[model samples]
Target: MTSTDTATREETPSAHVGPRFRPDIEGMRAIAIGLVVVYHAGVSRLPGGFVGVDVFFVISGFLITGLLVREVTTTGRVSLARFYARRAKRLLPATGLVLIVTVLLTWLTVSAVRWREFGVDVVSAATYVVNWRLAARSVDYLAEDVGASPVQHFWSLAVEEQFYIVWPLLLVAIAWLLRRRPGLRPRRVMAVGIAAVIVPSFAYSVYLTSANPATAFFVTPTRLWELGIGAFVAIGATLWTRVPRVAAIVLGWAGFVAVVGSGFLLTTEVAWPGYAALVPTLGTAAMIVAGYTSGRAGVAGLLSWRPAVWVGGISYSLYLWHWPLIVAATAYWGELSGWWGLVVMAVAVVPSWLSLKLIENPIRFAPALSRSNRLALSVGGNFTAVGVVAGLVLVLLVPSTSAPAVTGGASGSGVSGAGALSGTSAPAGTVDSLAEVEGYVPSVVDAEDDVPPYPEECQVDQVSPDPVVCEWGDTEGDLTVALVGDSKAMQYYSPLDAIAKDEGWRIVSMTKSACGFHDGMQVASGEPYTSCAEWNDAVVENLLDLSPDVLVTSERINDALTDPTDVTTRSVDAMVEAMTRQWTTVTEAGIPMVVIADNPSPGDVSPVYECIADNDGDLAACTFDRERGTADSGAAAQLPAARAVEGVRVVDVRDAICPRSRCVPVIGGVLVYRQTSHITDTYARSMQATLAAALVPQVEAATEDAEGS
Candidate 1:
């Protein structure tokens, strides 16, 4: 019989009435926890160590489903409230402690902007919606640019909690159906359900793994099959027990090998939870089944050892506490500290162990409280902890009035009151206050009414020009205006579409992901520029034929110029000359040409918001220095190349960002930059006025001079 089926003959007075301990399970937990710790500590050998979480999922599914199955086999019904109460007792104490400590650490160390961002995560985590939130944000967990989130790792926990909420109801329904149909076996039904869910979910996971890896990695739906693998094993324990001891031992060894092999073989690039995930998850199931069936004490004895059991016992707390501590430490140190980060992980385990022993175990097994009282305490404590966390986050989010006013400064220097632009000088002639336009510059266009109309025939889905056509504005006017360059150019659609509306120009957007307007430079995706060159050729041919009044383009020549040593190479210089030639083509065609500057290079700041939030409201502490923001040699090269062109007016938003000594990310009252490198949409909108100011005068002057000619 399964351990879960063996109820204690002696009834205890305690509210915590369950199996006293399961050492073999604890040993499995040790393996899973150990993999995670070693992986995060930068053990290069275990690159696929993240699969440890998948192992945990299977283990949880097996154990939890085994308990439900056993309970329903004996009793007529499963108690949903009682099951949830048990989950609360198991999960909340450690989670609540971690959240509180993380908040305290963040308040002391993180900046205001980062704190606010983390607060949103904290709230999402508390509500068990972190998975959806991260997916919505398009966060790539594996990407180096991902910023520190104090609670990002909790996305898994959120998935688990969500499972807990629904799993009991499904289990109860299954039990009820079995009670009605004596002919139908519960085990067979469960087996079919597991197969039905696991097979298709695995297929979908594999498909999504390559298409949108980030979504596939974090979403619970994609990962559900891993848990189902464990559920299948739990229902088939009777068949598993019939296997010989030696065969069981062999299966156990094979399963262990699979887990270790998966950890070493699978990588961030592979499609996960598809076929790849079956190795570790099925292996874990195999080991669990083997341990149960094998009469041989060797494998079971090893798993039941005291040290392994202890680590396994505290695994939940360890998982909960380790990530935030590591993330916070990394944020403070400014990089993943390699070996030094191991020390932080080690330090985190102490508190986690203590909490497991003192707080979690005591509350879980306490006898003084009745079942209803224990339930009340668990529910009340969880909500109260959530409330306290939310309240503290609100206190941090409220902007500080003590912050000094940032005035306009001298050219290329600090903000000075003397150089501040008057309210009348603000573009669009609608903004009335200097303070309103000071750090806040709306981008060139604000509304659909601001730009002109587009023609019906010009409306197209793809960002390429066939007959050099485009939908100009809300009205769909067909006055063709070409949009050219790379993904950087694509990001300008919000501003460019607005401009097109204001000018009554049809936006013939011709863009590629990272392929700039350069002649022969490599594109951003590391591919040769054959497709980019052909696309540019096609665009130039279309634009020449259409004879659009204005040509708008952005220079991503910086993407091709990576090495500082090769800054002046013939190829690099030729790329610059080609960009100048394109400008000449526009000017020669009697078209007003405008070139927008490329944005700053990307950075390694996935948890930037969390870092800022941790630092309280100190902008100086959280913001990356100018050097960190623009470390690329190519960004500087593009600036001079643009300036070299005589008639082309280079629109530089750098002045608005870097008033002096390079650009610090803070602007107005908000954190201007989202990551360490890219300016947030919030900050980007603030610069709209400055961008408009820079472009309007040049465009107006050209228009007036053309009329005179």
Candidate 2:
């Protein structure tokens, strides 16, 4: 999504000749765009295809800096107005067009629930601040599992735009600092300024990538060094001509290997663009430097081919058109197969070609705009205005409903949720469609937000290891119940709390997202889940110390693990063994355990909330095969451990979720799932009485056994 120029400007910008063309740079753009396109098209062989963006970052930095430095050396000053006008003319027209088109595509094809978020994303993209917005969302635990935004690729464009704004000012400042010192060359001072950006930004990238990798991916600070690497090449362009011809050839070929090879070697599992990013960025730098020293030789010669240049010509438009097409196609036809993905990518090229011809070229080459900087700036401003207004319109169009929360009454008593399935009364909204489900607890559009609220300290996120306890129910009651494990365990907190209050028992909640109460190592984002392991240890220690009468635990069991070689592997036997050891340790301390089986996830089905919104009358469209939905639940693996451990029993209440073999969208006048496998707070609350019928006896028996022992 990030590029220096559109098709017509592909031949523009030179390292030394002012406005001379650089065919090699054009070819590099083609390669970069190709890597990104292929990677995103579901090519399993190109796990590191995302590194293409890093390549673009380098190219953008080099070309833009070269142009600015040329102007600086010629005029002895930077013309801020004209500089921005040129940028606006080149980048804004295509970007704004893409944004408006993407918003409309989302409205027509995607679910209404996502429209508000996507609309907000569009505005951020228009303002060139989407990188920061995406960074914030990356660290949000609730948003982590949501679908990718169609405009998510705009984050790279945002990073480059931020650089375009600040890097020029920084160059001016460097020139100003050197004005009085006649002995200093401007390039040296500029190089020092570039290093100032590179060093700390790179150090922080490495630090943050390890500490919070998700946020690190989208933040501009972590990626600034990538652009700075290219700036370093531009500042030293004159000296690159002195590089020995043989060395230049070696550098060009080696750089080409590094850039393309990194795409094959790297995967999303690695902490991105930290130290790992150096391969592609440095490789790009080498290629550009080599091209300057030995024109039409080695890698430069290959890149100068006409086909490469043609693709490079349309790289910007291609990058913009491809992602939205993929997103929309996926929405319409479900998860695309590899061939279908390739077809979608091919289809995007037509629009890319059309947009470059009809939208980008006409605006960029218009005589009226070229004649006046103010006119060009004004045109760019209007494009941005159109984008912003379009995005807001999408936000305004999001659907809303006024459904009430379930109150757990008998079917005839204004009841909703699990009560109908429990045969307490006929469910209230069985005959009503999703569009106008009068008695539903939460409208379909609001389902994902229907989760129960928890104190920040109570349920830890992926990064933290400390276990913060929250006491609920009858806190002063004698009998103690502790809820433990990951978010799966946390989902049952509402029902458990209700049961605790009615039974005069205290409830202690100790849970972490993705961290089950197990002794085995877990993997997340291809890295060792060190924090989850630490949290598990801490929670086990807390449980042993408190020795609550009963400990309830559940989690999605199909967690990835790292073998000795650091390769990701999965083994049900390993999970069972780990659970057995952890559960035995707790039960040995006279604390009986109750394992609430994990629920079937709706994630494999279409976006649940959206599907219901579209098929309000035909809810069957939202149904998924029961076996496929529960395949990853890990309940079968859990039972083996539960049976092997003494004083530990399992409570199976899945019937309340999937009464028949198929998992349904709604049950008993209630939206069953919030997101993924997690049930809505209202649905969980409605299950209080049903859960109590099955769970109270087990808790009583466990308590009696504990007292007798």
Candidate 3:
């Protein structure tokens, strides 16, 4: 077997030395980095900016595979230790510095709750398991309302590191097999390896992309095929080198366009790595092959430019640093808007470039340590970082032992007592006096009209009714009002329950996980989801029969509006019609009907909470306007549909929750929203005065009209 040429070609020393830098590749790196930055910076046009990572994967595969093949051919064995040592020298120094700095910054700027979470992420990132950690956490990279994290970019680095761990060993095995068969060509062996890995991995990727896109995107196994494609090109370099210069230039430029274009067109909504991902991955492969085959002057000239090469030199560092900076900046400022966000991005590149130059390069080229010592040091440092982070995380995982104190007494500030007008009150028979009115009855469905209980198998423990008959608001009362709907309606229990108790009303609740009171949507298993529809029908029928003086209902119907044909729409419309029909039943029975509009929903929940928590009470850290729930047109469109029903009084709390064109998380020392999307039970309870203030008048007016008739 002919030996591999592992030595750096003197003609291109930079290509094979410690840096092993490629200018065109660096230019490509610049392009990739630019796309990601612009996309994350909230540029609306480049919906596909996320595909830049795919480009990076292809580049990494080409370079790492080339290095491994060369080393295996020349040395007769691949050095796992040496390869890892070199990686450590190249990656750890800058990464370690960033981690330490970010931790310190987080402690200073973030709240105690948020700091703990960031610290956990820091530990996960330092240990190189950030990808799995994020996947487990269900971190949605495309969620628009999420707060930025300083270390989220590390997930891709973790993926690359995982790839390096396995690839070298696999190559060593292949090399050993080739050595046994003297007739075997290295390129042929590599081709088989690539094919063996790529086909199944790609197939699995396509499958997982639909079933579990988050996992497919973050995990190494699912992503290996994209890298393998580039590996194929590297192994067959000689064949590509035979192509003509003009052809090479044309192919390279065309590939470049495809890769860049993919970034602008593709979006998070697209099923990735199934078919849409081909555009960028194939484009990158084409460019790599074109550059290798043509060896043309124009292609070389464009790639060899100083600026392109310089950015490429620092590409790894830049990629690592940019995301965290953006996230941190966004978290600190709430929303990065106008030129301010751009300025943050620009300022971020400065430290990133500097770190690459001062830290990353020096560690790799340092002469003080021998290869073995360098390897040991690198491994030891990573291990130490991991241990420290792990210890801190364990401390956080330990649940708190003490219960928090509740502030405000029973019959808390705003709660009213019966038979007496409290504070500056409205007269009897007026809306304000409605608070003083006793014996407020809740509407309920009759025994004959009760819908059957939903199938036991379908109910989720936290979200459904296995623990049937949830009681809130002092838990002792004869008059019960059942609260029902999805998470949005569930969030209102705190305030409603408080008010219920103060007014001597009992609260019974039935809620389902993400199941809007829509009729047509299917359950997780693709079977018809009859629970929501059945529950709503039962609640309405029960209200009519039980004859509670009031029927209070709240639901988030906006999600149904995302797709007009969605089952949510049919279910929600059915629910509204049922409720309207029930309203007639209640009105005829002398009961009032109170329908609360669903709270506005932010695009992402965790990120918003994270941003707010991270900012340590900085108003700018939160992104959504406090006054508005969603900017999505789908949400706005639901209003007219809901309002058209007769005798169903629509109570819009948007004005109470949001006043100044912004719906802030905090109102009068109480947090209006607990998570990004929902208000905290404690905070929601505090808003009882505001809610009662808005609702009492409507209830009293209806009650008065009923008595007059």
lDDT tens per residue, model 1, 479-530: 5556676544544454456665776656666655445665554532222434
Query: Which candidate gets the maximum lDDT versus the true structure?
Result: 2
Per-residue alpha-carbon lDDT of model 2 for 1-709, expressed as tens digits? 4768742343344556546667888899999998999988888888898999999999988878887887777666787887888888887888888988899899988878888889999999888898898887775656754678988898999999988888999978867766767678888888998999999999999999988898899999999999999888988988898899889999999999999999898988888878999999999999999987676667889998999998888998999889998998888788887678888888888989898889888898899988899999999998988889888998899866534555543235464567766544443323232334445657766777887776766888887889989999899999889998888887877778777888999989888877788888777656778888888899988998888889988887554453623645767777788898889889888889998888776755555666667664356677776777676675756778889898898888887777666777777677787776778887788788778988999888888888888
Candidate with the larger TM-score of 2 and 3: 2
lDDT of each: 0.60, 0.81, 0.58
Score candidate 1 by lDDT: 0.60
Report clashes for each candidate as comma-separated counts.
42, 1, 33
| lDDT comparing candidate 2 with the true structure | 0.81
Q: Across residues 406-460, which tens digit of lDDT does each residue of candidate 3 receive?
A: 2442134432222122233444222232233222111010101111133333223
Superposed on all Cα atoms, the candidates' RMSDs to the truth, in angstroms, are 8.4, 3.6, 10.5
To one decimal, what is the Cα RMSD in angstroms of model 3 from the true structure? 10.5
**What ranking emerges by lDDT with the best candidate at the front?**
2, 1, 3
Instruction: Return the number of clashes found in candidate 1.
Output: 42
Shift in Å, residue 175, candidate 2:
2.6
